[model samples]
Target chain A: MNSMGLALAILGASISALLAGIGSAKGVGLVGEAAAGVVSVDPDKFSKVLVLQLLPGTQGLYGLLTAILMLSRIGVIGGNAVELSTAQGLMFLGASLPIAIVGLFSGIAQGRSAAAGVGITARKPEHNGKAIIMAAMVETYAILALLVSILLIYNIAI
Target chain B: MGTQYASAVAVVRTMENSLFTQSDLERLINARDRKESETLINSKNAGTLPEVWEMLRTFAPDSKELEIILYRNDFHNLKAVLKAMVSGREPDSYIIQPSNIKNDTLKEAFRTKDMDVLPDYIRETATQAYELITTTLDGQLMDSLIDTACMKAMQESAEKSGNDFMRKYVNLITVCADIKTAYRCSKMNKNRDFLEISICGSPELDKESIIRATLGGTENLLSFLGNTIYAELSGLLKENPAEFEKRCDDMLIELAETSRLQAFGIEPLISYYIAKEAEIKNIRIISVCRECGADKVTITERLRKLYV
Candidate 1:
């Protein structure tokens, strides 16, 4: 039972990182393709397109932060070892779910928007700032999810 | 869906800067001599007609894209060869040499008397057109045969593309050409026999109604068009046929440019190509008008709207 409790807690940390990381990877790949397309024509605009390409990558970092925070909160890192019951482990998993589910979907959606921003930059570099803002708007949901997961994990009894 | 043309679209975005503006076209129209026109074109790093055409050929994304845009030339060359061959003239100067159908291959097909060398879309008409003039010596009959074949090929290709814009373009061109054909046949007093072979069929326009209207006369034709999407065309046809053509061409440009705002798609790439083609066509028109020493007013009236 103790082993199962530890396993579920580890699974929760993994989900937060893995799902969000996968989403960000998918998003960043899509944006990179768009950036490559723009750079193929105008090599000078690489710097501009690079920013758009990196925008969708934020969700991955957010997910990683949530995973790290949750890992540390449950004394699974360089802290005093604690034998968590199955219900407590399940609670930890539930808390991580906010970031895990949201980050995954939000990352891919943000990447698509960022790719569109790259197109705008390719055509009219002057509007790149506005394009960036538009793409950044999609990251709001991911940020909200991160905040909720952090609050829940922090309040969960050790 | 649009990713296939990402690189090409990117390239097309850069190419937009090269399209001639209104003032540039006005200068070309007002140029005094061929040397002056050549100077203006060279200033922009685009030489004369053939040079600009070569640039487009070099930049086209794929052979299918090339085929769609240049098939008219291919059909024109085949028609020219059919006409020239019967008259004992060399067909070299008449051929446009499409990427898909090589001019040399066509020349060889003629020399060897084997039309199989030609693409399927053209082989039937090329053979029929050649035999058409050879047997009857009727130039009009040969002309209609090739014209019908060209329209059919365009229709089939547009249908195959499954693109809405392409289908609309096909509809506009066939309908416009049919209107012109109907007008010409009216004066010639030709009956429905010529109409049956001449008019290109489109799902957008009822061929039977148009044929009936054409047989009835201009009033009947105008009445029929009034009820269709081309309602405004009836008035334009009565007032000025040239303006009517310009309006239809403008509609096509608008349809193409609508895709320009799209972030991802082959639509923008294809639209840019169409716009460039229209620009080149206008240049050719103005260049020819200047060479012919046409009056500025007449030349201005004939010039189609520049596609920017």
Candidate 2:
């Protein structure tokens, strides 16, 4: 029963959720502020700006998914916690790093992009799809990071 | 770091859509009568200058940078109050709104001889101008002093704010004003002392050089201006003073256009204010021209550039 190893793995899961969630929180909050400004002027714009506001939220969910998968893979969720070596614990931490780091940055960056998109939507509602597409472009890296994190989590030897 | 004012910028962008477009201005210019022009303008629902100023204040209440935009108006009001005090007349009619200093505050400052009531930017100028006007009874001198002080305040505040957009704004305003003052002073055969007092120099146009050029006369001043980056303005000044004034305003609109590409920060807010000012100016021009029964070409030529 390598307690240190299990602790390290749990620490890894926490970092993934914590860092990515922080990023998403900041991102979502920034866009929300901008969206609220537009909505204040034109309440009819709620739906369009709301869509832009939601763009930065995906990183947080990806982080949560990574944490849950990592936890399940280590048998922590099913009440059968595996005795992992220090090396195995380090491997789990490494696996979470991609999403933890990428999600943290991409969320904020995407938030900025989406916030600018909100401006476009505010000015020209008809061109909202263009704004959405521009903001969505930043999501590709977050998605890739999520994919890498998931693959790493699933393949890590218990 | 410059991405500050995200929400404010967003609101400005939304408001930008409501600004009068060029075509709108054309229609406004060609409106059959003053009543029709007023109707066209009213239909735009573009908020008044005071309303726009209030909205901007609400959004960026803490922005010292935005306050610089009103220095000209504040100084103008200060001049009005001082003149009214000298002439034993009420200043209310001449005072403009959307000023940083309230009308009552200005009047109180003059009545109580307490400059402290005014903002630091104008406090000293108020005291000095009041003394100079009361003792010398030189309204023109007082005006030059106050106008120069306004330019100095604008430039100093813009420099302190470290905002390039504001710095450029102040520079353009100072240069245009100095050029105009020099041209007028040169035409009137103003002395070196007057030119020295009136022209608040900028990096682009030095105070000493402009004064010297004006001393050499209007030709020398125009030649001096011709060599500078603002050569086009010099030519316009020589050809048509009214056109020169229009071009000066158009240059500011050109500067405001640069801020349109900015996504965030106080620049966009400043840009919106400038755009709105131009729109209002265009409306005023059209109204006055229509009232004067000026021809369409005359009205269109006088119209300042539109932001949209």
Candidate 3:
């Protein structure tokens, strides 16, 4: 039984969740602060700014999904634990890197875009869709990273 | 770039929508009577300058950079207090609102002769101006000294904050003040001593050159200004001081417009204050013109540029 391999796989899963969660937390918090400011001035704009605030939150979900899939693929869930070689554990770690790194950065980047979008919505509520589209454009990279992470997790030889 | 004051900037953007537009000013100018104009202005729900200042302070309390915006008012209050002390008149009537220093604090500092009670930016100037006014009893001289000190303080603080927007703001203010002072001094035939003390030189308009040109008379001063980047203003200064004043204010609005593109930072917050100030100024002009029964063309010419 390679405990070190299981430990490595667990470490990879933890890293994916930890880094991406931090990014989303930071991104969401930034937008929340800006949205609260607008709402404080004009309460009617709450719904518009709320949408902007939620834009940066997707990366955290991607990270959680990646971690769950990795844990399940390695049989760490369902009350079953599979013995993995050191190379296999390392491969699992490698698979998590795309989402871990990309999710972390894209979350913050998307948050800034969304926060700026919050300003647009605050000023011109009629153009709220433009702001949403601009912020959503940053999500494409995070989606690509999540796809790659899932593919690697599923295809890795046990 | 890193975004500072993200929340404050957004709030300012929201507030920007409430500011007066050009057409609003036109309607204000054409209002049938003072009552109508007042009603139109009140309906806009544009907050007072003090209210705007309080809101900004709530958002960016720690920003020393934003404090520079009120230095002019602070210095004006200082002048008022000193003049009141000299004339034995109450300063309350003349003291301006939205000042960085409280009126009571300024009065108390002067009453007790404890300059320490004043903010560090104005402490030395207050002390020096107090001493100069009491001894010489020269109100104009005291005013020049305080005005020069105000410009210098604004420049130093803006440079220390390393904010380009503030630096340019201070520069524009200094240039306009120096040019106005030189024009006035040249007209009065003030000596070199007065010119040297009154003109706070800017990078664009050198103090020594201004003094020399003024000594040569208003013609030389106007000629010197004509060659500078502010050449367009030279014609306005020559024909009408009122137009020159309007041009100076319009230039400030033009500068504030540049900050409108900025999404994040204290620049937007500062520009909002500028916009609000212009809106108030426009309201004041319309009220006064309506009271004086000034024609639309005259009132329209005097109205400063709108931010929106």
lDDT scores in order: 0.77, 0.91, 0.91
What does the lDDT read for residue A110 in candidate 2? 90
Query: Candidate 3's residue-wise lDDT over B153-236, tens digit each?
Result: 999999999999899999999999999999999999999999888999998888999899889999999999999998888889
Candidate 3: interface RMSD in Å?
0.9
TM-score of each predicted structure versus truth: 0.85, 0.98, 0.98
Which window of 10 residues has the lowest lDDT sum in candidate 3 chain B? B29-38
**Per-residue CA lDDT of candidate 1, range B160-278, in tens?**
87777677777777877777777676657678988888877678677787788888887778788888887887778878988888777777787787887766565676677667667
Model 1 lDDT per residue over A1-158, tens place: 38666667778889999999988998898788778767865799899888888888988898899889888877778775467888878988988898898989888888778887877887788999998999899899999999999998888775
Q: Name the runs in model 3 displaced over 4 angstroms.
A: none
* Positional deviation of residue B52's Cα in model 1 after best superposition, in angstroms: 9.1
Q: Which stretches of candidate 1 lie over 4 Å from their true place?
A: A74-82, B1-4, B27-36, B43-67, B97-99, B108-120, B123-134, B293-301
Ranking by DockQ: 3, 2, 1
Docking quality of model 3: it rates as high
lDDT of 1 at B51: 49
Cα RMSD for candidate 2?
A: 1.1
Error (Å) of candidate 1 at residue B36 is 5.1
